[model samples]
Target chain A: MKNIIIASTSTIHGGEYLEYLLPELSKHFKNCKTILFIPYARPSGITHEEYTAKASLAFAKINIAVKGIHEFENATSAIENAEGIFTGGGSTFVLVNELYRNNIMTVLSQTIKKGTPYLGTSAGSVICGLSMQNTNDMPIVYPPSFQTTGVIPFNINAHYLDPDTQSKHMGETRETRIKEFHAYNTIPVLGLREGSWLDVKGSKILLKGNLSARLFRQNQVAEEIESETDVSYIK
Target chain B: MKNIIIASTSTIHGGEYLEYLLPELSKHFKNCKTILFIPYARPSGITHEEYTAKASLAFAKINIAVKGIHEFENATSAIENAEGIFTGGGSTFVLVNELYRNNIMTVLSQTIKKGTPYLGTSAGSVICGLSMQNTNDMPIVYPPSFQTTGVIPFNINAHYLDPDTQSKHMGETRETRIKEFHAYNTIPVLGLREGSWLDVKGSKILLKGNLSARLFRQNQVAEEIESETDVSYIK
Candidate 1:
């Protein structure tokens, strides 16, 4: 059985970092005294120490200890031994690169499959998918491969935004980008909006949030899955 | 001398494709009877014939002929012998993949260096940079390498957008994405706004159009380069 939470973002608008999801996370990571944090994403290029401290403070509210994978000599062993694992958001490219460089992607997948509680946000959530092809993050750095943990059957587009009806910007909208992704990929993509998350238990994946999620599949119209609906069939 | 027009976009908010840049392109490609069109970007998955027809329709106004690279038996030779070259906008990842797949990345650079008038919009302009690290397009496909033609000294972030003060979206802003790129790479980046373009002639790179482009450098505050300014010194 697999237990996981893939969140669209770590924070919602006007909310403290991870504060909006603390209640849910508390339940998901319950019975866990400590959680190993993978801070390789390093949003805004923050130092590993600085990123870990933020995660530590957030987890403190849940009365859980937080430790970074970097703090240990063996990251693969760290994943195997972690009671719960949380990968924070930042640059998906950087996160994927570090995961490959550490050669712990396989171990991380095995850890989650073995029933260890797992949580991912933004770049973190994107890594749970089959590929990093649907990521919205800039390719700030080239990763050795676009491969991820394969904890989930499909890909994720985190922090997905709807087209602005009044905007004048000429950039492709979120929907357009996903369509382009579908042009070359057969994998289904879930456009996870901020504040939304997918609750994974065993073989089931459910949408957990107030808002609906946009599901994009090849050769089909993009459909919005209502909150709390089972989306495991997206595979 | 290298002659190129690296535009931020092919179409403005309310203009037809390439309509805004026609006058400038006409002059830059003057005396060139025909121009080679690389439709590899394939915006919205439009086929080569369809995309080429669109380009042909647009170039008709300037009395220039359009031909897609796919029509040629050898894409490498097509680029090398082109009188003028225009690479349209779409997915940068796809364009780069096709360029490498066709084994023309080196020849494309050599062709442009030999002084064939060239024009690129969005993804095309991005490849003219040091790397595609600054592209805003989604990575729909994986390319052999993120390396591109080093025609320009800096990377390009086409369709560059400003942060919306009133928007509630928590996604990383364009500025934040670029700063993240700077974390792992020291290459300079230019955020070229819609309707703005770079006039690259000889060793001079001048910012054209009415809008001021944003220039971001590593470990330094981003600056706004006024239109018509000689920005060749950025190198």
Candidate 2:
């Protein structure tokens, strides 16, 4: 059975318990050979050696032999051989670009179909959605602004935040940005707050987090959903 | 002479002011009828009647016979007949959508060729650029995302607020969003902070604002340009 753990972070990453994620992840692989996807970590300007070192720390406790997909020139072999995939967060755009350039999204998609456990955090979690349109990041740095790996039909607004913090510095509020997104298209957006994880095992989508995820549909007010309920109502 | 005014707001009507902009605008419309385009006011959720009243208030003070393009079924007619155009700000996406739907962008391009004064504010300012790729809004609402009128070759990230405000809110920082935009393409972005405007008259691109605007080219560090002299260095 293929299983996926789409999360915002690893460790006490973004106000959530890493231990909680491990329990669910543990069920997927008896001997997890976790392939750490570090596409988002490029923002730190770290060399390949440094990036690999940092990622290794995150998986030190797990029994799996962790490695980054970048170690190989071709990602096809890297993805196919891995028992499980763990995507760490930094920048969603960067991660999506690497995936697109390597043409590994299709292979990963097929692997997910085979029931290989897929774990995505923050920016990593975003690529597993239909489009990155709902992301809080800038959408126009390239020729094609709306492309994704198509793990899900809905867009995931990762690191999902509210608008109540320092209003003056953050520029526009999240609500305003989402509303602006609504003006262009009617795609559903899942505002997955930090510490939240959407577990997809088989066809079931289980929300595992302390807080409820906010859902925005076309011309509709953002509503909250309970953790245990299936996310079939997103569309 | 064709002239345009892309402003942060209409200073005459409680919108952001362009004290430095009026003189330049006046130079372009020496003997032309100034038409004010108010497409961004749709977000107030007000009836057309109420919105027109607000627009008229600004037009009346300028001692110019100003008409809201929204008053007509074909807004392009207003653009076609007017000697010059001034688009006011409210919402960039809404303004772009209305302009696209009415085919006024094509009209505005022709009007500019006739030396019509084309003035835009906020959303209007953004529409003046190559694309709205750098906008600080949400990605879900598309507003015909890639169908910009293409008056300029580069895109503008309007309302270009600084990134220090992230601590106060849960939304992604402005820097992060723009970085995400960079991941998809290599188009240069001019982040126009509040109170700033870019004046492109007969190939002379002037930067008018209290502070410097941030310019990003590819993967390089975003540099700040303080004055017209600094803008000249960009090309």
User: In DockQ terms, which candidate is top?
Assistant: 1
Task: Return the lDDT, model 2, position A86.
Answer: 72
Q: Per-prediction count of colliding residue pairs?
A: 0, 39
What does each candidate score in C-alpha RMSD? 0.7, 4.9
**Which residue runs does candidate 1 get wrong by more than 4 Å?**
none
lDDT of 2 by residue, A109-168 (tens): 787768777888776777778777666555443313456666666778877777755343
Q: On residues A133-154, what C-alpha lDDT tens digit does candidate 1 reach at each position?
A: 8888898888888878889999
At residue B99, give the lDDT of candidate 2: 70
- The native-contact fraction of candidate 2 is 0.50
lDDT of 1 by residue, B1-235 (tens): 9999999999999999999999898899898889999999999888989999999999999999999999999888888889999999999999999999999998999888778999999999999998999988887888989999989898899999988889888988999999998888899999999999999998999999999999999999999999999888886
lDDT of 2 by residue, B1-235 (tens): 3234444444432333445455665565556555555554354234445655665555544545556676767666777777556666555556665677666667777777576667776666777666766655544433554456556567777777676632533345566666656655666778877666776666556787676888887788888888563253343
